[model samples]
Target: MSAVPAGSPVRTGAVVPVLASAGITVALMQTLVIPVIPELPRLLNASAGATAWAITATLLAAAVATPIMGRLGDMYGKRRMLLISIGLLVAGSIVAALSSSLVPLIVGRALQGFAAGVIPLGISIMRDELPSDRLGTATAQMSASLGVGGALGLPAAALLAENISWHALFWVSAGLGVIILGLVLRFVPESSVRSGGRFDVLGGVGLSFGLISLLLAISQGADWGWTSAPTLGLFAVAVVTILAWGWWERRTSEPLVDLRTTARPQVLLTNLASMVFGFAMFAMSLVVPQLLQMPKATGFGLGQSMLASGLVMGPSGLVMLLTAPLSAKISAARGPKATLMLGAIVVAAGYGVGSILMGSVWEIVLVSLLIGAGIGLAYGAMPALIMSAVPVSETAAANSFNTLMRSIGTSVSSAVAGVILANLTINLGTHTLPSQTGFRTVLIIGAAAALVALAIAACIPTRSPTPTPPATPASAEAPATA
Candidate 1:
């Protein structure tokens, strides 16, 4: 529980690159399977609906794993948990690579999902190990890795799929996991920090079940008919479980999540805005690739290949990486609140571009870059905002919770956007595709989400810019005489 001695050496160079690489590796898993998704039914010898479970399984597993592993990292050692997460990624990739059927593939993908905890854990490590002055920049680049990995994954996977066996995709993932796991072991240090409390097994289980029920309902609601009994039942279960989880967390001394800390104005509002940001961020990813690949016969569709779609989205990821350092500087100079609000405005402007210019590849690329830069700025500042408000011991848990809020937002966006596009489809001879109006409506909603977040950020009570009291001046804590 004690801090490292003031002058103890901190290895800034090695830690930053290693943790950032680990983050990008884990994030790449989310998009790795995308390239092989359409052919899954044939590849795995399953019905279309059954094959879709590959995606759903990852979502459900990630939803459950992130919060639980985060608390584990706080209680035990961050590096230890980081290694475990990477191990799962490697094992999962191997399982998926060797599988010839749907069941193993889904199971493997879920295991990969368990590794989603890596990013938050990595962020926590940076907090514990980095110098105070270097903290902002390191965390910003670490956070931006989420977007970078996803953007890169698409094109890389698309290239493999086009040129090689679909199984090669999982093999690549496995190889990357192995290499990164080795680097993490070599470079990342175990923190002396520990909460030294009993694990809240009950709280963890309740939260897992609650998140599963909630995400299942959201992800499956469109396919099952939103009003179906199963969907409604899961939604009910989710609400009851979460409410009960909250009640239990309030009373448990060594709770998995400290509810009192999370309820503060700065933390609470930041989490709320993160949810809206997640919703807004996902709208573009959901819309853009589809817009690019849709048959040109639909007129508005660009009719690009899947590889081309991924290629176009690649620059967005680069911009996110390039913007992270600037975001960190802004947060350091002004405040994360100002940085977050700036991000929201930029994102709104990006959507504005999309609304007016949906015609060419170059135009779409520009819009995506703008939005990606906004996301980088916003993502980079979130951890700084959360860490400032909570005790140092709770950093991992707090960051984990914030990540969960974003996931929840993306889940909602998926369900809502899916329904909009599905219902507004136009039949073109042999196949159906989403209407131009559907795409426009989604963009409009995305812009609206960014603006809503901006307003929420504005409402967060800003701290008065208090000048520090003179160190030796008369005060209760200051000694009158030595």
Candidate 2:
């Protein structure tokens, strides 16, 4: 294996496509169920709050799984872990499809959520398999696709659900999962790099509990009064557990996360920016559909159907797909920091535009395009920044950490948006707009978050060099021969 040069074309042909498809699969599973949320009350004979758990359950599962799986991949093998995650998605889809009750559906969604690990795994694999010259573009494209998949999946799922049954969405996802599994088996080569350490079962358990406790509190706090014992106790446990987990990681020989490298200013700031961008981007995903599909009698709404509302968000994903390569080019020229700053400024501007003009469906769509472009630019830069700062050995872990941060941002934002929309009321005589005031408040929050990210980007020292190529074993051996 050492005889093969790192940049040798042998691996690129097989690896790149597989990694890209893996990313698409991740997005498909994550977003496919979103369109079904509004319909869940009728489908499962549940209340509105209970139905929302389908989305929340998936988020919770993915948040906990991403970092653990990334660490596992680093310790064992990326290809093996990728296969495991895809398999889990398939099983989850099947379970979801077969379910007649909300419990089964939530279980299935939780299972499928594990697939979120695929993004960080693919990004890490790209770092490992691709040459330095090619790495930037490949990672950028993969990172951008997360937004693209989300953008595209909403319409695809909405159209399917509207035309057929909601169960069809899961059926379609299962079919896609099978295809992704085959692709991985055929094209993705196993990594030779392995860490000879046992899995830290205790540490993983502690981390999972900590995250679950924290997320549970944040997500449920609005429904259950913040003063409630369950909410307060969960928050307290989360703080203590997370602190304990950090100490354990510092001492463990095979820690679940490498805290030292993650603590670096570059990696730390990049992750923070990712969280903010994630929060800002999710505002569109959460609010736009509500604004569009809401009954016109509600005064502030356009009364678009679910399918049409989803279609509005689809173009943003398309824009993200188109803008990714451009983002890579900008990062290559002006550096990732500049690209991130530019993206944040664009996001803030997009929200500002949204605040003024979101009364119509087309205006919402137009703002989505701007938001998608901003996400494409900013999301692409985050992984590049992280990969640059950490050792190759730490790529998966670092990327996973960054991915986790984005999830955190999205979860926090989703909960906050829920609160804002719930508290504000709009009354327009015969018809009351659900609450234009709430929408405005969330948009303002998003705009401010984007500005904070921009400020952080400015603070990131521009002196750090672009990532350099790793020396292949072949190159090292060549010197001996000479």
Q: Which candidate number has the best lDDT?
A: 1
RMSD of 1: 4.9
TM-score of 2: 0.93
Instruction: Identify the candidate with maximal TM-score.
Output: 1
Residue ranges of candidate 1 with Cα displaced over 4 Å: 1-9, 463-482
RMSD from true fold, candidate 2: 3.9
lDDT of 1 by residue, 336-417 (tens): 8888899999999999889888998999999999999999999988887877766666777888898889889988998989
Residue-level lDDT tens digits of model 2 in 1-482: 12232234546766776677778777877688777776789889999899878977888899888998898887777778888999999999999999989999999999999888998998887776777777777788788878888878888998898889999999988998888888777666665555547888888999899999999888889999789999999999999999999999999987888788778788888888889888988898888888898777776789888778878988898788678777878888888899899999999999989988878877898899998889888888888888777766666778998999988898899889988887787766775455887888898899999999998888876644354454343432121110
Worst 10 residues of 1 by lDDT: 465-474
RMSD to the hidden true structure, all candidates: 4.9, 3.9
Measured with C-alpha atoms, the lDDT of residue 207 in candidate 1 is 98
State how far residue 167 of model 1 sits from its true place (Å).
Answer: 1.2
State each model's CA lDDT, in order. Answer: 0.86, 0.82
Candidate 1 clashes: the total is 0
